[model samples]
Target: MSAQEEIDLEFLEVEDLLLRTVPGLAEQWRGATPDEVEQLERIAGRPLPRFYRWFLSRMGQSMGPLAYPSQDFSARRVLDCYARKIVAPNPRFLLIGYESDEMMPLHAFYDLDAPARGDATVTARYARGGDDPIDRFETFHEMLSWSSLFRFQFEQMSQKCEGTLYREDADLLSLLAPVLSSLGFTQPLTTGRYCGLYERADAVMICGGTPRENLENVRTFLLGGSNAGVLRRILGEVAKESSLEVEVNTWTPALR
Candidate 1:
């Protein structure tokens, strides 16, 4: 199949699965509580796909707080860091990027307890059976697991679930709906409210066809050849329009 055709099929299949798994998604969304819809809308930055919205509102796991399928974190620092960080400020979630043709499973975690002194450090682990370790980087970007999980499953279901039985994607939003609804417990105006960036060649391709294409499109625009110029432009726009009046800060305060 042609690349575009492949993308179309994958998108359609995901839509189907979402519908079958989460019933009444479309109808309920029309009447979804304003707060619930707003939260989902913010993560997506637009009206979501009906099936996607359905999954969040209905099917899949039960909704409540940040609690989900908990795994013993005694041996998993990455997960430990993620759970610890999953609270207020949304924590930092990582994304893996690569060339479009490269298909590798990538996982990222924050090591909050590690010896590193730079706030938080991210560690990316990828299967190294191929030519390169999956592209890696560390940065403090605020994010939530539900959104991160959504991205992971979206990409996985789109590309790798071709032969799988139940599709690697699950309605994870349901798992965290409870934690999300009680936002009063957490402070809202903190720098921790950002999501990390992810990039890959296949992502470049996928972004070209979907509503969120711009999320990565911005990354490509800034990371491509003339990155500095793009950065300045973005900063300029933020400076012009943002309410916080952001200023650049450095690590020099500690050196003095």
Candidate 2:
């Protein structure tokens, strides 16, 4: 099989595993037809990488939190969104998935001059100016796999932390809100008990009081729960995004 065909088969296998292992995790979504895929190429004026085309053929329009856009928004629309300055405003990159509130969108730019082993640079555009380098991958399959794993991890986190709270100092919570939101956290919500919850997908961070108090709350959650790995991964991501210098040992026993 060609490399693209092999990757497509691998994705199908992973999807099958997720469906069987995770209850209520995989929902059926309509995929695009072969003609539609061809149409998208015509619109873009260039051939899409084989793996991405395969994704469109298999998944059609992904729903819920898959982060892939639906077919109702055509590739032409995506290109126009960038060309007309409605989104990324960069004509060189093709817009894939756009989450406006987070100011981040998935983009792919193929080096047309390069050899056609389907080489492409896929990156997340995290800012409005479209100038900064964000998370990047060498291939479309790698990007899709990473996104799928993150969605699975977030689902696990939601199941574990449902109705749970991580109370921190109110002042500290306020200080962290904007930073977290910029890193794709949902807008903070008042729990009406003098605390607020900031969430993204299944990952949540509760804020209330002092740093020490908050640290303890995080520690208790991690040590007392089976979802510590997911939470720790999230914390690492948050710390990286916020550029905060956090000691590893301060958060979880595993690091200690």
Candidate 3:
């Protein structure tokens, strides 16, 4: 398949997962028009990579909670950064995004050579010059998928679930819902919440997708409530049996 076609599939998957998790948030999605894309292309000085072009043409303006993601989409930002001499852009690298470290900012780039093969990797470059020697992700799709996950984690902080468990690219809730039911944790007695959300006496799971498969990740949050300590052990058993790469997030600072 073409790179743009592959990106379309990834976008659909992420969009479906986002809708399941936060349907209300999906209303914010606004894709860029063809004219807007053409304008950005002009500013870019050359044609964008296939994956990026697809993204800009179909949801570049916003993606709900992922509206302003780490990957910089506005070609103007790249031009501004280069104009200010903040970072030198490598000719073979497309500057997608940057993150600030203690010493300097790290820039993310897509290698110009690999996009058409339908498997491009994003790599980090030093703020001033030279390669950072780290591959950020095997593909742009993977990077966006993970970015959406982190954004959902931030959004879930304000949610009612005590701790959530997430397994990437797999039907997590299906594998766990039966276990939760067997353990006597039926559906919560709440209204106006996600249909598939489940809860026991201490913790709540905000997994969505219902009868459909849930492929997004979030579970095992250490943000709050007295349930963290108890659920941590339970998750170990769940991990051993389920082989989910269960991870513990450190205490999240209170959102300002």
Listing every candidate in turn, what is its Cα RMSD in Å to the true structure after a full C-alpha superposition?
21.0, 14.0, 9.8
- Predicted model with the maximum lDDT: 3
Tell me the tens digit of each residue's lDDT in model 3 across 1-256.
Answer: 9755776774565445446544565577666666666654554466766667765655566655565534455445555566686765455676666554546566776665555334356767776656534555546654554444445543344322234566666656556666667655654322111124444555444432211123245443332223445455556665776756665544333223
Candidate 2 lDDT score relative to the true structure: 0.45
Q: Which residue pairs show collisions in model 2?
A: 31-60, 168-208, 168-209, 169-208, 169-209, 169-210, 170-208, 170-209
lDDT of 2 by residue, 50-71 (tens): 6567567555555334544522
Candidate rank order under lDDT: 3, 2, 1
For candidate 1, give the lDDT of residue 248: 30
Give candidate 3 regions above 4 Å deviation.
1-10, 19-49, 61-64, 68-71, 79-91, 98-103, 113-119, 154-226, 242-256
TM-score of each: 0.21, 0.45, 0.51
Over the stretch 52-128, how does candidate 1's per-residue lDDT look in tens digits? 33333332223222212332111122223333643221223221111122353344433332212122333444422
Q: lDDT per prediction?
A: 0.28, 0.45, 0.52
TM-score, model 2 to reference:
0.45
Of 1 and 2, the candidate ranking higher by lDDT: 2
Off by over 4 Å in 2: 1-7, 10-26, 68-92, 102-119, 126-135, 154-256
